[model samples]
Target: MAAESRSRILIIGVTGNLGFELAKASTAASHPTFGLVRDSAFSDPNKLQKIQNLSNHGVQIIKGSLQEEDGLIEALKQVDVVICAVASAQVLDQKLLISAIKRAGCIKRFFPSEFGGDPDRTRVSNLDHGFYSTKAEIRRLVEAEGIPYTYISCNFFASFLLPSLIQPGLQTLPRDKVNIFGDGNVKGVFVEESEVAAFTISAVDDPRTLNKVLYLRPPGNTLTMNEIVDIWEQKVGKHLVRNYISEEELLQKIHETPYPENMQMVFIYSVFVKGDQTYFDIASSNGVEGTQLYPLIKYTTVSEILGGML
Candidate 1:
């Protein structure tokens, strides 16, 4: 079924920053969105409000915890496209998601949550997080089942680097001090959240994106952390401190942070540094530049992403 003709698009873990944005983008185009929330407590209030904000715009809020089979079954009812937007949902449990979708049996397409790093990398052989491993498993199951699915390998979120971390959240940092995990010159792809959402919506809307890793990301231009730090400092008119912390130091300091989540953040960054994960040339892969994600394709450059933030 074409996306617009479908009754609704179901977004699992809708109460997240990216999930909500994807729903809104689809709904804005008159495509009804069905969002499955894990539960009340796990749901983010701001993201919830964002959905309510779209109430008039045509979004269906379905309360379903990923832990409950009935919840997944009910949430997916009438869903034509399923977008898995969860973080750290283990591979074992992700089976529950796919099984439920199979039970619903109407799901035509799905977008896996492989949002960072290339799975083709040898470093991926050692991927440890429940997030990476779960996505890997889900992809495997989809292939085995011959279910229609799209694996979105977004390079990295630009916001993840600075606003989310590399700077603590609890206190206003004295400066946007950046920690360079690699040689401050590694060229890596980082995308803005809106750009990611736009590309995601386009993925489901376009049929050619199915059964492919619709690597929908912003401009492939990558910038070094040092370059960004320098520009932000210059634009903001202050020398935001730059700390060259060792991998060992970061691992230790992550424990020091009050946020328990920092531990995972540290590990993800460590993988980004050590893994063979980098930007892909989308124009060459799957034709995302032309047919899959034509209009929503946004390319953000290092200087522009940083300078705009400043």
Candidate 2:
């Protein structure tokens, strides 16, 4: 496809982790890329740096927020593809953006903020901190509005969860102990955020991915918690004590904890204990494996990620 003929992508939440990467990939793919960012994002030093990065990469900046429907509709009018990479807190907020997309009626494809497990398959209720339910709601709205959409079900983020050895809050690799959910053998698919972004951007212009879910399940990246710990152990040259959080115990934690913490526990149980990411057959569903779709893309594996951490 000619550069100018490529889909013009407008990524909401460009300052965010995945959103910025999507911007990078979109531009790299010769797509006329745009970013829908709030004016306030320029004030935060961290966000400003990202915004500056986007600007340097030739991403046309659209000064608009989802809250401002008028400005959002105007931004939507300028782009053919709208990808929302907003944080979990703002998943429901996409309803407004959806309304605006309907009003603008120019977007060829809409990628909602669902760069995680497929809510329809994962099956979580109230204890989930409203993460899956809210995303599922947005999907319904997208379909109801008859908006062309692609759902990126790129399960667990390796950078976020693997660094701490799957320990929820810890930011670094554990030295003495790590919590192993269940038998430490329930597998999950973990793709680094940037790779997820790249695969997502690749699907923007794909007809097969239109109104279908793109599952980022690289066979090499599919791993269990025990396998991850084994990799860390080999890197550190020492074995860490395994603190097993059984399914029963995990459910107890989810029920006992409060708000966000409770929500975290719910995810731990869902991903690790229940094995939601790998338990389903993507081929049977309305989805295609990202690696299968784009085998040429060099996806980072868990070992490569852990090796770099050291």
Candidate 3:
């Protein structure tokens, strides 16, 4: 196939919420969007529903698994842009995505599966079970190669904290309650998943984001959970529960469970209660700093997001 214009984008993991949204936006924008589906899926009806919904949005689905080398390579050949929206826990599969993009020989840009907290030196250790290392390794391999890559180390997804809203129970850990890191004053960029896709495409479209580890960050209005709860208390019209936990205890829980979901629990236990601002994003919210193209991040507030959802 002849090389197409910059408008063509192939978004892998298209069935997921964020991927699905990006595909729709890209399609609405008139950019041809393709979705990659794993032929051997390990899920259920809702997941299938999401995938079927993609077809409704006019996204082309290429059935293949990241584990299938031949299949991945075949799918990569169909598009110039590739977004690995696969799960971070699938560290092994990430390597395959990179290899497939290379094998296709048509890919001009490759967006890795990283769409979460900063994996930079400061925050990587705090990321859930092995996800940080997996992301770091992928980024390392990309740097060594000549492939154009963008690592959107988008800071904490605000929506990821929705559990605390429905089940205020998570906001306070009764067991070995040592909240936040130290004094519970660490600030982090809390960008919504929706904003992440937008920022990602913006960063990817501008050639400057290529080959660079562009940190996808929310405009930091950094506030502790205690501070945030005060605002929420007013909104929910109830006394919000808040607590402080030691980082050491949180790490101990992680040491005990070591499961992805548990690791996330440890993180939530740490961030909201203890309120650590140790994490920071490299991508400038003002403009794409240091590169030729200026990339600006649009920050979404927690309340604003919840309001829309409710």
Candidate 4:
């Protein structure tokens, strides 16, 4: 495919971890990619580095804010697809972005910032933060406005959890004790960040994915927490202490922990305990399994990703 013929993609939150991967994948796929950056990114050292890296990759940077209607509309005019990769804290804030998309009236597809669990299925609304509710609201707005969109439900990030062996707040792979949420048998789909970006970019122009949730539950990547622990044990040639956090204990943690951390606990409960990701069937009316959509795209399994870390 020629660069000029490909869709012009504009990513709203390009400085984030997943956002950067999306930008790289878009450019790699020869799409004329654009990044909507804020004025403050130029001042922040880390973000400035990422901006420089993105510019080097041929992503045309359009300096604008989601809050600024005129600037956002101008940016929207230049792209066919708009993908928002903002953090969970900024999910609801995308309401403003959706309104801007409507006003611009040119965006062919809008990928809202929902790269985790499916918000509609996950019942975490009563928690301190409105993570699920906010995402659900954004989905409603996108549908109500009749914006052609794709919701990427990539579930757990392999890079985030696999690094620490699913142990919260630990950077290194645990050598001794590990917290096994529930019986550790509940399954979840874990995808590498780059793989998520690759599959997401592949579906950008795919008609099958339009207005449907792209569930990234690759067969090799789906596994129980206990199965993940067994993989690590095989790699280390030793068994670690498995401290089980019972369902009741996890509920207490959700109630006791503070914001953000508590939010993480809520997600843990939803995926690990409630079996939300694997429990539902993807009806043809709502979703298309990503691996099945593009069988040629090889995804790195959990074991392979963990082995690379060591």
In order of listing, the candidates' clash counts read 3, 0, 11, 0
Candidate 3 per-residue lDDT, tens place, 41-114, comes to 42667767877777787778888877888887887787778877776667557777777677778888888887
Q: Which residue pairs collide in model 2, if any?
A: none
Task: List residue ranges in candidate 4 displaced over 4 A.
Answer: none
- RMSD for each model, in Å, please? 4.3, 1.4, 5.0, 1.4
The 10 consecutive residues of candidate 2 with the worst lDDT sum are 122-131
Task: Tell me, by lDDT, which candidate is best.
Answer: 4
Per-residue accuracy of model 2 over 1-310 as CA lDDT, tens digit each? 8897899999999999899999999999999999988989989999999999889989999898889999998888888999999999999989899999999989999999999999998756756767788898999989999999999999988866777777877888898898899998888888988899889988998998999999998887888889989988998899999888788888877777777766656777888888888888898889999999998899999988899999
**Model 3 CA deviation exceeding 4 Å by range:** 1-5, 41-44, 123-128, 165-181, 237-241, 256-261, 268-299, 306-310
1 versus 2: better lDDT goes to: 2
How well does model 3 score by local distance difference test?
0.61
Overall local distance difference test of candidate 4: 0.89
Q: How does each model score on TM-score?
A: 0.77, 0.96, 0.79, 0.96
Candidate 1 vs. true structure, TM-score? 0.77
